[model samples]
Target: MNGPGCAAGFRHHTRYARSMSGNRKRILIVGGGYVGLVTALRLQKLLRRQLKRGEVEIVVVDPRSFMTYQPFLPEASAGSLEPRHVVVPLRRVLDKCDVRTARVTRIDHARRIATLAPHVGDPYDLRYDELVVGVGAVPRTLPIPGLAEFGIGFKTIEEAIGLRNRVLDKLDEADALPYSDPRFRELRARLLTFVFVGGGFAGVEALAELEDMARDACRLYNEVKREDMRWVLVEAAGKIIPEFGEELSDYTRQRLEERGIEVKLNTRLESCVNGHIVLSDGTEFDADTLVWTAGVKPNPMLRDTDLPLGPKGHVVCLPTLQVKDTPHAWAAGDCAQVPDLAKGPGAYCPPTAQHGVRQAKHLARNIQRVMQGKPPTPFKHKNKGAVAGLGLHKGVANLLGWIHLKGWPAWFVHRTYHLYAVPTLNRKVRTVVDWTLALFFRREIVSLGTLHSPREEFAEVAAESAPQPEAASRTPGQPVPKAGAPKAG
Candidate 1:
């Protein structure tokens, strides 16, 4: 699609050639994720002149209709932004590209064919002249018993909404019953006893925001006290936010402790049996909520593919972002292990969103060059450092080169960078509005508990009131003794 906002024009079906007698090649891209969208969008613009050849077609396949900007997810969960704004619709942004909302079940580079699992119905095969694999990462889950059944993963927009609903509903359950009821108090504590694993960006921000929200909500409940609830963060490492350096980790730890959150460093989640969470440290905790954000591995789709893979299951891409020796195929994002040319140490770039975005732009340019028979340039980006949000208007950041920031300044950077990075003007404005509204309005403290079981309570009552033929037969006004009459006579 061509637009004023777009850097260049993009058309998908047609191929670019110098003459009308064009033998156009087809480009097949996998995973309509962040890296995939950017690569396709950039190629459409860079190779606009090429698509006019009417020979080459570009096909993008993925399960999601939209690409979610994950950094804004915490704010979305915290009610700091509307949920809808965090996702960018695939069809609206990539014009002229054949966007297929399907999963790529298998890829055979040896034969240059990809098998696609359609969103519904039958599966089909798509043969392409070139292939791009940008299948992003998935949640890294352990084999701990009840991990999948009892615990929730903090990935994607769906899980974010689920967490919010579950949290509010638990609060409502606590408040609905009389304060004197033990079940009511136990439920209230269970609701607030939320546990999060992993101390990375996802774990820290989620823990802090939810902790802040819960602490504020305690003001509204007469029985639920701030001290009564527990917020535990379990990290296998010795410190939280290791990217923030030693001092910042200490600072964050202090900040959380002040908020009454317990940080369990050098710990592991052993099991979650019947919501009773046992730790490697021999500590046991019974929680109604458990969130796992330990880490992530590349999508398993790469395992069966013919492309070369790294030790971590990431695609082996050259400095040019092309699959090693395969000039036609390219990859990026968490799924690709692109080498850092500048370092000269043969080190792979970290699996981070920063690297992913940078690689996408480079890959876009290289694809354009490849389509035009021009030599592709290699990708080399300097480390830009890292930043993290600890809680509302508070954070820590390591700026470009080596400058470290903390308190409000770091928080400002965190907000500014994320707000700028959040795709589309509509989402940006809506997020600002959510924050502004929060300044004036009281935090929405009312939890809609009935949403969990709108009918179960009534069903229980109905079952109790249901008529019993045995009881009715024995009632004073009921006829009974017909069979026994002959015997009595």
Candidate 2:
């Protein structure tokens, strides 16, 4: 807790004395992601009286103020859903709790203090009686050549929308060039080619959705044809969406091939230097877009805490979702290695939205059980299968291990399930509205890349208007020269 400005005074306050005097217990949640938001919501209902009587306090902290519904990311990127509708603003929903838009730099469980680094102000320590660690996992990346320089990740809302604009902009670039020239053809091919690494749900869904959108957009362009674009999916594994089993995996691959997508199995990307991709199969191609969605690793921030972690760096949690050997500390979601009692011994819950949602509710109940001096129940839930959207009116689903759905039926199920799963009623209505309007109208293919750098044009104008040193030093009789005009000797 020792720091420059406020740490000395903050350390002076004893944790026990503060709780003793106020008769209030503070619950600090380290993240505002899936588990964090849901846990806080459940706690509000379970401990409503204590919260109203000022007997309990809940604090949620995260860098971003909104919780993104990740399942709808592909649709958002493909313009099927509005970008704003996919992200729920935390402040609006968790109105009862104190939401802090900051990052927890470190956690000291032995002292019950968490160091928070705000966006603007100084870093400070926060004291809490109970702690919930749900910081979530980050995209697992490899140290590949040129990967960091020219790789797009499909995780957050910003990246999703940005990728959408970039794809459309590439189409625009290709359309502007003359088709008769051979040099322009090569350049156009590069611009139109899209490469996605990893055969997981994220890579498949993103590649499929964007390719469909780009194909539809080609109808309006005179030069860019659907055949001119190349959509390639590179996976090191022999199968895609392996969790869905071999039957669905083969079906998915065959379906993607029918749509003119190249699915390379047991392939690895050796390098992508300056947009030129080199694969392990000795294939080389120039591309303008590369998206990496290989896998995810536990949040590296967990190493800064005093809690015990598994070999994979995830916080080890018992069947009750409590951190092992640590009382009053809980964890779940992608960052915690929670024992999957439903799956039996040596098994852990997979990092999926379905499990995270269920774990949050269960973890909230366990917290209440401890408060009531009752033994916490073990967390258990049967696997609900998996569903994925490929493109407009195309999908695949596996329900209850016995039921299999494909094409439009699976697509409908995907949409319906996610609509029911999205956080708030407001977002659900807005998403449905977007889908309803899409039925009567065409998809908007406009590229809004300027959103990234809105001030570029203004900055250029200001630089042009700026007075030069020579102009400033000129005599009073000398004429002031106009910008970009000839200079007098």
Identify the leading candidate in terms of lDDT: 2
User: lDDT tens string, model 1, 15-127?
Assistant: 22122223667788898877888888877777676676666567788899898988877777776667788888888877768788988988888788788765555555667
Model 1, 289: alpha-carbon shift in Å?
0.5
What would the TM-scores of all predictions be? 0.85, 0.94
> Tens digits of per-residue lDDT for model 2 on 1-489?
335544544444335336544568899999999999999999999999989998888999999999999999999999999999999999999999999898999999999999988776567778889999999999999988999999999999999999999999999999999888888988999999999999999999999999989989999999899998999999999999998899999999999999999999999999998999999999999999999999999999999999999999999999999999998999999999998888989999999999998999999999999988999998999998999999999999999998999999999999999999999899999999999999999989889999999999999999999988998889989988888999887
**Candidate 1: pairs in clash:** 1-95, 15-53, 15-54, 15-55, 15-56, 16-50
- Clashes by residue pair, model 2: none
Q: Give the Å error, residue 430, model 1.
A: 3.3
Worst 10 residues of 2 by lDDT: 8-17
